[model samples]
Target: MDKKNLKDESILNHDDYKDQHGAVVPPLYQNSLFTFDSWDSIDQAFDHKTEAFIYSRILNPTVKVAEDKIAALCRGEKAKLCASGIAAITSAILHCVRAGDHIVTIKNIYGPTNKFINSYLKTKFNISSTFVDGRDVAEFENAIQENTTLIYLESPASLTMELQDLKAIAQLAQSRNIKTVIDNTWASPIFQKPLTMGIDIEVHSASKYLGGHSDVVAGVIISNKEILDSILMAEHELLGAKMAPFEGWLILRSLRTLPIRMRALMDNTMAVAKFLENDERVGKVNYPGLESFEQYDLGQNQMTGYGCLLSFELLTKDIEKIKQFVDSLQLFSLGVSWGGHDSLVYAPIISYLKELSPEQFDAMGINASLIRISVGLEHTDDLVADLHQALSRIA
Candidate 1:
């Protein structure tokens, strides 16, 4: 199949499944080790003279199929499936930096990822990172140092949904010979193509949209063969964070329906976002799909669609009212981690108030009354009604 010419939906269905007795879906290879025919064959496999799957830790047929599909989806030369989103992220970061290296990243990054860069990397490897507001390309430019080796980004970042100029930052990083990596979980491959926009590496939390269901927790890294191979051979193998065959199979099953799910999610989310934007109870709706959003144009330039995840600030900052509103919602379940079949509502104030100081919360742009909604496959009218009822309680 000519993947370059295939549409996003078609690409998901173009997998080669000829080897499993004409089965439409690829069969799972759940074995931990593949037996070698002879010592000669084993030697050849070890020497890289012949293609083989020696151990599940290094590679597996089931996982390889998923990796190939993800790579094709992202328009990348190769891909690696890791145990979790953080595994993929940390492995990719390890490949790009050494001791004494520096990284420039956005302040509103994923919580655990921010911790990994700020705490773990600094403490263990002597690596340093500068957190910057990524809306302005000048912020990234100003943060670069002589030791800077990587620029990390999460466009339409975590809570506030602020976007970065991917093309501009990619150009800037390229000019300075610095590598670029992005967490493409929000857009998935269906909505955005970061690699084509000059990003050196693209990472996804396959636990989210790619899986389309909450049943799996996995992640993937997509890049050209050279960078992928380096990470695969070194950090990935050493960390022993390969995805299980069962999880790989689950992601493959999800990919078959990703295009349809994403479309429904976009439609449903837009409806909810518009409702929130017009409601007097809402202070601001941080979603790229909203024309009023500050970075809507930038988002339109880089992304084909605004994803399901969005956050809104309530008109009131009262903690009890925020709790009352969240507790009053009937359809949207309170939870963390989005991109599933059920709508989820997350209140940062409820979860982080005790853990984070007022200054830290301000720095991350997470307001005390902010509520994040992850629109799911529910009917749009029902979701809107749920919000309307919930807002009435707060009023």
Candidate 2:
């Protein structure tokens, strides 16, 4: 069946095994191991010839259901559930890049991801990477070397909200036989599908939109069977970063409401973005929905909806003034992370990188006046009103 039908017909509507009570929701199979009827049955399962659970580390019925749902959502042949988004990203890269291999990445990727490749991976595995401004696909091509094994990117990058051309980059990677992976957390499958543009693999922090409520912390790596097997065989089993059964169940439950939640959040976000754009205190708004945005045409072409997350730089790069603005907001909470029912506001503090000097901060796009706001499910009028009061106090 086609992907949309697979999602709507089987994956979305499908239910896990239930007890005699006929409970609709899947119960958490939280056991570490399952008992086998016989040695023959165990042997068959070990040989991959039967559908039986040997151990939770290797497989769990609940986790498998969630993996299948996300795999379908990503339009990949297979998917693997991981303890966290970083685990998925780490495993995916490690599985492909051996010692002496190289990777090219967009500069504005998540801070931890940058650390992993540049610092952690380099020290431990002798792997090296080049960071480039991925807004220009040529930068990726220019950075590629003989040993370049992978290209990693996060479009509409988390803090900067910069959009990358997935199709162009995927095609370039294809010619060089290099694998491509994207952190699709910002624009969930509801907004963008990387696989359709020929990306080799897709990764997500299910902790964000996929989990929806910010209650669960999980990650997913979706790819074809070949890459999935190599990853699972190489590090997935040995590293033991698998998601728990109950966490997987929670993600499955979250999937049903993803479309609805995303729609509401986008509606709220569009209104808020417009409010910020019109405000004189806000010097610049970085939302794809805004007509004045640099990549507005590309966003309209590639994304289904302008995502709920956006960033803005204030007219005055005053730290105390920015903090006061954020603090005065009664509706928005000052915290980390997004894709929750409650709105969050993050100032351009040093929470991203500890040793990042003032020079480094200037090198990156962030400044003291810049702040990232994640629009939640709150009413648009209330959110706008709160933002108005906060900005009014700034002057």
Candidate 3:
């Protein structure tokens, strides 16, 4: 984390209003179950009509407090935590679909998400999905089938950082009586809230920016009570994806300074992106914050801040150069996930685009030398120097 963020961490205690004993931190309801005073009270608790806890699998004070805070922060009527981001995603999608239903989703989503919906859900539930370029509103409009139940989107469409016109798509979905679901992990609610813009459901990989430390792996769904309750049955209970009390506490701890942390990280990202862009070896930079980004204007309209995750391509297709570039990085560790205090690097996606024709590959907006980066809370100069030094080895 940055020096300012580190110093500001203990300046504010977030638990004062929620704590009864002035403990200054929300107490962990670590037990699996809570006892009831009377038969009537037990029955009421069973029906979820009382504040009493029944089981940790169903409800717990520590988890509930985190849920409340996330809902308030994201401006949603209700929220539910889950064991992982895929849990939140799968549960939410199932909540909106059934056997023989169809969904239209953006082409470039998180890999696991694309596989889960296209492979798992398709085989198990007879559900079908179409992947489209989300930048074209007409594409989403035309992909709708008679059985289409959902319009799924990932704005700044994950890898490509291609933004969709959320308000336009939401309007079309509402007119067609279809609901919208978005994986808002990239921008986070700190930068964007899809619900207020007319989207029906929003999911985040709390393991990312929400946790901010890379130690916790969790996810959350934010929406109205009706949708949340439906998923609570269809996905949460049946699928057994409840968020544990300790996990909830971890996320709650990170939630206190998400705004400040994100701001600092954004600074780091913009600097690194700009540095890479000015280098002759850099082919393309996929970051909404960059003025050269194709969807820069649209991203500005929908989001208050561009997130720290970015992707860029090199001018060469040589695998050896790719290895040299990645292996030479001093600070960025090679990892899969992002939105943490430590910078991470991932495999070059261009190797997988080999099957596509030149035109087709260009259409996808990625190439063989492309590297995805998640800028962390490092000093901007250090992060820039690291990339500059690595690129020099490739050159």
Candidate 2 ranges beyond 4 A from true positions:
1-4, 7-10, 13-21, 49-52
Residue lDDT tens for model 2, 150-183:
9998988988888889999999999999999999
Clash pairs detected, candidate 2: none
List the candidate 1 regions with Cα displacement exceeding 4 Å: 1-4, 49-51
Q: Estimate each model's TM-score.
A: 0.97, 0.95, 0.93
> In model 1, where is the ten-residue run with the lowest total lDDT?
43-52
lDDT, model 2, position 91: 91
The residue ranges of model 3 lying beyond 4 angstroms of the native Cα positions read: 1-17, 49-52, 348-365
Model 3, global lDDT: 0.85
Lowest summed lDDT over 10 consecutive residues: which window, candidate 3? Answer: 3-12
For 1-395, candidate 3 gives per-residue lDDT tens digits of 43223222332234435566777788888899888889998888767732347878767788888887777667787888899998999888888998999999988888788888899989999999999988889999999999999988888766779899999999999999999999999998878989989999999999999999999999999999888877875678778899989999898888888889889988889889999889897988899999999888898999989888999887878878888899999999987889999999886454454545656755766676778999999898888889989988988
| Cα-based lDDT at residue 34, candidate 3 | 83
**Which candidate has the highest lDDT of all?**
1
Per-model lDDT: 0.90, 0.85, 0.85
